[model samples]
Target: MSHKNKKISSTPKHTIIKALEKAGGRPKAVTEAADTGSDSEDNSSPENLLTPKDVIAIVTKTIQSELRSIVSELRSEISELGSRTDVVENQLDVVSKHQQTTDTEIADLRAEFSTFKDQLEDLENRNRRNNIWIKNVPESISAEALPDYLEGLFLQMLPDLSKESLNLDRAHRALRPKPNPDQPPRDIIIRFHFFKTKERIMASARNAQSISYSGSHLQLYQDLAQSTLKKRRDLINVTKVLRNHSIKYKWGFPFQLIVSKDGRSHSVRTPEQGLDLLRRLHLIQDSDPSTSASPSQQKTSAPTPSWQKM
Candidate 1:
């Protein structure tokens, strides 16, 4: 009962056999049967009966030999794999460097394309520099009489300008379907032979704030390229913020929003510049999308005048 309660050893079979040879009992009979097998002899001939220690030693040596062979094969495979990994790492580094060079070239091409696009837009705007857009003129005036009508309107705006000097190269309604009488009249685009005349009329009209012809109020705008118009349109939010702050703004040549403060001018060239200016002035709370701040934080921000300042 006491022997049954004792823990069995977890050591190798050789340790158990050694212990049994020292203890003379039923274990001796068991050992005798186990040691007599063909595979049990350690170096001794098969004709002689083998002892328990000899059998256990023979089995241990066989297992150790198998383990050594497996270990040798595994080591060889591991060494080969290490060499292959080094080559792969070198190849990956070359690929990484090539990717970096390709990325740099792509960036250079994109920059050149951007420069080309801006130059093209600038050329388009310069071509129409002497042109002006007159809106809300009544359709009652025929195309033949548009030239005379515009002359009269310009005289009304600038009473001092001589009639002979208002040399309008061309004046006509926009080339589109005429709006219904109830709808507002299509805009009239006029190209003056001289940019100076156009500039004077535009300046006078701006100072007057509004122009009226045949009792109907008219609006004046520059005949800008579609691209220039889009650039201005994209700044609508920025301009809206400036307007809300009571900041007066005006457009400059080559596309600039001019703002004056303390008799000094600051200009905003792009929408991002407008935003940064507003942020710098603390006109709006930080509304970075990366921030945890909610939607209510993004509503307000405020803009600009100068050829170069800011």
Candidate 2:
């Protein structure tokens, strides 16, 4: 085929004709004559062709339409994700608030329990104020005979005590099963009608060198709450150290052990504190064990002097 007759393909002819006119090298009459010949030829032929400018415009329009659809889909997805994030944040806030309220309620309950415990302890101590514990008295004495026996015992032990001054109220053993056949009976607990009478009895007991009934050695002690009794027991070693050193000391009410040395009194609450004080006074060696005194030793020991009433 001749070079002029060899036609382009895959492009519209008018597009090429317009491009030729815009290029201005081809005369306008020649471009118009080419367009007329192209229109007269078979329009369905593969040789029909378009210009580069037309191709660029068509591609740009198709790309723009696809981008618009993609953008619309992305916006919808983003809106749904934002709504889900807001719901999750709201749920987290509710959970945090509930945890705070639960913590506050637990704190309140703990405070209330502490207050109730203190009040209950106070009541227990108050109930024991006018009572005394007597040990080594024979279990043979019946409860009905206890008051009279105690009165007579007091009168004999305490020279200043009178029958009318005794003011006895009630007496009984500890609230527990009787001891085994081989073991001794429980201590007798006595309650006096008056605190003054009880105080007098305790003072007399303290001043006495020894107390006995039916050849059995008897001991007297204040009827204290179990907690207070345990605390006092813990102080037995401290008491022994003071006594061995001739250091004056006494047990104050509600579990305070007071030691007087060089005219200065030191109050001790725990066994550790007592041991510390004794170490400072050079009364007991550091290696000494702070074991409580045995029952027999405690009974035989002299009462602590300079007792103070609280």
Candidate 3:
């Protein structure tokens, strides 16, 4: 036997006997039999005593139980977070779709508005086709006699025109009130019953070079919508520059001014285009004062073109 076996064997037999006696209601004979059995067992047997390996096994099982509980809680939290992330992603998808829809609607509205504006402008221009504007005529006649007076003036300006041949419709001054009492009277706007009659009068006026009544320099021009008139006025400077350079140019339909040079023709719609042509032709030098002025100021310094004299 070794020292460890001796130590285990040193446990008092009386202690074992007392433990058996403590078993509930055991007879004295049964307690003595248990003590005899304990004495007969080999004291060196390892199964009868607590050991380091058994303690380590118990601690390991306790730690494993706690670790399993922690892992389960972490898994549950991760599952909840994943669900919330899915909801956020879905919300983002809906917002993106709504934004796309709004952008599409805005584009559709803009396209419709642009088409409607073009149609309106076309209608307005068509209404003025058979009309003419006469400016700088003295307002000696009353409104009631204005139509007859205009017809008589037209007959005087046109050699072949007569009262029977001219088809008069209506004649009146501009609609707005005079800005100043001393300002010249508003131009007469005349609508003819026949488009041909309006064209014939305009041609005769061009041939006569200058028309005057009551010593006032009267002028005849085709009636145009205010928008078209503004665009043409904006190009007045360009026309003057073109005429000065001997560049053949004419006003085309719907507010286009076409210029022909070196066997090639270019259409201009804005003052910038005309300035570009002038720069290309070397007609406008970089140091010129008109080059730095606004388009309207440039026209003030340049002479009026023959075609636009009226």
Candidate 4:
């Protein structure tokens, strides 16, 4: 066990272990096995000494063996991972196609629903065609007398029209909730028996400028379905622009506004189209705040003489 007799290897095994440790990727088993080899050298006879080349070759052989084992295990795992990736890619492709199909179906359903809604709204408007909305009518009369009261009021506007011609099919306040006594009287909705009579009444009311009942200023409006009202409200700015330019425009059937300019008729169907028409006419500036605003966002314009929310 003399230190002089301990020189079995020229290259110290401890230096090799340190180099492996500094490299930092070798497994702990590599260091442990090197330490065991170093310990065994202490017991070996000097006659059985290893040269520096022999020591280096042993370390290199062990490192290469460990590396080959690691490479083999990694290749197996990488092959399994590649198989899993292929499965996942196939599933994603299937899911992407399914999503596209769902999107197309949803779009079709939405279009169908929109068409149905427009038809329903048109039906509602047609049902209300013969109705006249009378606002600020005094609440003093009984429900049974409401029709008679409305008939008398219309007769004053149309003196030539007989009382029987202005006969109302139905008359009632557009009542909601408990009546607020202090608020201006609830509006009266009167349904004329004949469409021609309703038209005559409306024209006469318009000519009179304003109807007065016992000095209470009465307002008249043609009853419109909520959807039709909304459509008109959306195009309120377009009409405002038209009036500004002395352009003649009238509301067309269903949901269109026909403009007469330069002896040609331009029809607008939607608010978007209304906006485009305004843009083409240079009626509205691109930077105008109303251009970017939605129909509801812009201040709601009322019918001339401000008959709304009836």
Q: State which candidate has the highest TM-score.
A: 1
Q: Which 10 consecutive residues of model 3 have the lowest summed lDDT?
A: 301-310
Local accuracy of candidate 2 as per-residue lDDT tens digits, 168-258: 6778898998887688888998888888888888888888888886677899998777777777777877887777778888876545788
Clashes of each: 5, 4, 0, 0
TM-score of 3: 0.56
How accurate locally, in lDDT, is each candidate? 0.73, 0.71, 0.69, 0.73
Winning model by lDDT: 1
Task: Please write out the lDDT profile of model 4 over residues 114-186, one tens digit for every residue.
Answer: 8898889878878888998888877787798876676677767777988667777888887775367787788
Badly placed stretches (over 4 Å) of model 2 are: 1-122, 284-310
What would you estimate as the lDDT of candidate 3? 0.69
**lDDT for 34 (candidate 1):** 53
Q: In candidate 1, what residue range of length 10 has the lowest lDDT sum? A: 301-310
> What's the TM-score of every candidate structure?
0.73, 0.54, 0.56, 0.72
TM-score of 4: 0.72
Tens-digit lDDT track of model 3 for 194-278: 7877888888887786888767788898887777778777777778777777778876665678888889888876777777777
Number of the candidate with higher TM-score, 2 or 3:
3
- Which residue pairs in candidate 3 collide? none
Q: Model 1 off-target regions past 4 Å?
A: 1-47, 279-310
